[model samples]
Target: VTKPYRLRELIARIRAVLRRSGSEPANDVIMSIGEFRIDTIRRSVVRDGVELELSRKEFDLLALFASRLGQVVTRDECLDEIWWGRDLADTRTLDTHVKRLRQKLEADPSNPIHLLTIRGVGFRLDP
Candidate 1:
C-alpha cells in the first residue's frame, strides 16, 4: 500500500515536470487559421467553431504544421520531431498522417487550401 502511494507521487512529479516543459504556451492557448482554431493545451481542433475529432498522431501533425506555418517541413524533420526521432517503420506514415490532417483541416483534400504538398520535397502549411 505504501509502495503504491510512493509510486503515484513519483509519477505525479514526472507529469508535472513534463507539463511545464511541454509545448503548451503560457499566454496564448490558441492557434487560428481562417475558420480553424487549435487549442494547444486542450489538444483540440475546431473548424468553424465546431470541434473536430483527431487521433493523437493527427493532432501532433497538425500542431507541428501550425507551429511552423508557411515553412516547408521535410519528411525527416517531421519524423524526427513528431515521432521523437523513432524510426517511422515506413516512410508512408508521414504521408498518411498528412492526408488525414488535410481531410480534417482542408476545405478540399484534393486541392488542399491550407496544407500544401511540395512535390519531391515535403509539405508546407499556408498561413
Candidate 2:
C-alpha cells in the first residue's frame, strides 16, 4: 500500500545503489591489464577485444583481485569477503574460483600474467 511518489522514490534509490555498487566513482570500473579488460559494472571481461563469459563467482573473484590490483589476497580473506563468512572451512571453493578466474583472465593459465599465486600465502594481481 505505497503511494506512487513513494514507489518512484524507492525505485530511484534502488537504481542509485545499483549504479554506485557496480561502478567505481573514480574510474570507469573497467580495469585493463595488457589486452584484458574487466568491466565491473557490466560484470564482463574482454580479452584481445573478444568477450568471455564468466559465472557469478568468477566475476566476484576477478573483481576482488582487480580491486586489490597488486596486493596479495589470502584464501581466508577471499572467503570472508566474497563468500560473506558463509562457512567456507575448506579452501577448495576459493581455489576453484581462482582457477576459473585465471582461465578467463590469463593468456596462459599455467603461467599466469595477471593472477599470481604466492604459495603457502595467497594470491596477488599483477598490473
Candidate 3:
C-alpha cells in the first residue's frame, strides 16, 4: 500500500483496495506529463485530447508512477504492489508492462523521454 506509482492505474487499484476495506480514494489526476493526462476517478488517459485504451496492468503500472512522479520505483516494489505478493521469480512482466506503457504514453516509445529505465536500479517517470 505504500508503493504509489506515477501511473494512472494505481489510484483505481488503491481505491478499490481501500474501498473494500472501507476507505476512500486518496485523490485524482494520476498522470499529467506533457501531452498525456490520466484521470484516476474516470479511469481515462487523454493524450492530445484523445482518450486511449489501456489494460488493467498498464493503467496500474502508470498509476504507480503517477503517485510518485519523477521518483525511481524499484522493480521489487512494483511487483509487490502491482502484482500483490505474487511470485517474484520473473521480472519480465514488469519490463513488458513498462514497454507497453511507453508505447501508449510516449510520443516515441523507441526513444522514450518520459518513462525511463534507470539501468540496474529501477524506473523513473519524467514530468
Candidate 4:
C-alpha cells in the first residue's frame, strides 16, 4: 500500500514493526574488509589488531564503502549519503575525508590500493 513512499522510510517502518512484534530484523551489525573490521553496533573499526580512531562522519563514510564492497560509489551518492543530501558550500569535503581515511587505513596514501579513485567516476574500495 505504498504509492509515494521512500524506501528508507519504508524500511525504517518495517524494522519498527518487526521490533514491536518481537521479530528482530536480520541485520549484520559487523562487517569485514581485508584486514579491517567494522562493528556498526559499537561504531568502531579495527585493522590487524589495531583500533583506528575515526570521526563520526569518517566512520559513516568508511561504513558506506564497506557496505558496497568493491562497487564504485559515485560522487553524487557519496555527497548524498555523507552530507545528508545537503548542498555544501565547498565540495572538497569528501575528497578531504577520503584523503584522511587513506592516510589512516592505507599503507601509502599517495598510492592507495584499497581506496582507489575511479577518475571521472568516483571511488572504489578494493576490499
Candidate 5:
C-alpha cells in the first residue's frame, strides 16, 4: 500500500515511466565518430572497419570516452561511474585500464594519438 497520490501526479508518473521504457529502441543507438563506430545495442566497437575485442569494463570505459569525444573526463567522474563511487587510494586501476584501452584503440599505444593523457587532469578521446 502507498500514501495518497493525486490522479494527475500518478498519471504523469506512469507516462514518464512508459516513455523511458521504450520511447526509443536500443538498436537505434549507433554512435560514431570518425573511424570509430559503436553499436550500443549490439555491444560492439568497430574502428576503421576492424572490430576490436574488448573486455566488458574496457568497452564501457571506451563508450564513456566516446560519448564525450575531445573532452577531458575527470578521474573522479570515471571512478564514480565505473567503480560506483568507490574511493580508491590511487588511480593505478584507472591508469591500467586506460593503458589497456589505448593499446586496443591506438595505432601506437606508446605515442597515442586518439586516447591522450592530460597530465594531472584526466583523459580525452580525440577521434
Candidate 6:
C-alpha cells in the first residue's frame, strides 16, 4: 500500500491488482457520470473529451460522486470518505472542494447541473 492512503484506497488498489491475465488494469475500472469519466485506479478525471486538472482531494471528491450518480450523498458520507474520519465538524473543506469541482465541470458554477447542493442535507450528482 502507498503511504498516506485510506482503507478504501487500499481496497481499490487490491481490486486493481486482482485483475489479471487478459484484463488491462489501466483501461478497466473506470466510473463515469455524464461527461465525467473517473479512473479510480489512476486517480484521474476527464470531462467532455478534455482532462481537467484536479487536486488529490478534488479527484477523490469527484470519484465519490461519479460512483453514485443522481443520488444524494450526505455531507457526513463525503467527510468520512474524503477526510477519513477526521474531526471536521465545522470545516468548509468539502464545500470548497465541491465548489472547485463545479467551477471545473459545470458551465455555470452558480447554477450547477452535475454537482448539486441538497439544501441542508448534502449534495447530489445528476448525470
Model 2, runs deviating above 4 Å: 1-23, 26-28
Q: What local distance difference test score does each model get?
A: 0.78, 0.77, 0.79, 0.80, 0.79, 0.77
As a whole number from 0 to 100, the lDDT of residue 29 in candidate 2 is 70
Off by over 4 Å in 1: 1-25
Instruction: Give one digit per residue, the lDDT tens place, for model 1 in 1-127.
Output: 2453454445545554564478765555798877888898899998887999999999988887777889998886677566655555688988988898889887779988789998888888886
TM-score of 5: 0.76
RMSD of each: 7.2, 8.1, 7.4, 6.1, 8.1, 5.7
In candidate 5, the residue pairs with backbone N, CA or C atoms under 3 Å apart (3 or more residues apart, or in different chains) clash, namely: none
**Positional deviation of residue 75's Cα in model 3 after best superposition, in angstroms:** 0.3
State which candidate has the highest lDDT.
4
Residues 1-127, candidate 3: write the lDDT tens digits: 3564444455545754774466435644455777788888787888899998999999888887877789998987688678864565778989999998889888889999989999998899887
Worst 10 residues of 1 by lDDT: 1-10
TM-score of 2: 0.75
Q: Once model 6 is optimally superposed onto the true structure by TM-score, how far is the C-alpha of residue 23 displaced, in angstroms?
A: 15
Give the per-residue Cα lDDT of candidate 2 at 83.
66
TM-scores for the candidates: 0.76, 0.75, 0.76, 0.77, 0.76, 0.74
Best by TM-score: 4
Candidate 1 lDDT at 91 equals 84
- The TM-score, computed over Cα atoms with residue i paired to residue i, of candidate 4 is 0.77
* Candidate 2: tens digits of C-alpha lDDT, residues 10-105: 554555456447745657577886677989778998888899899998888778777788899887667656665456567888898899888877
lDDT, model 3 = 0.79
Q: How does model 6 fare in lDDT?
A: 0.77
The residue-level lDDT of candidate 5 at 40 comes to 73
What is the Cα-based TM-score of model 1? 0.76
Write one digit per residue (lDDT tens) for candidate 4, span 26-125. 5657888899988987999999989999988889889878877899999867776766455566878988998898899999889998988898888899
Stretches of candidate 4 exceeding 4 Å from the true structure: 1-27
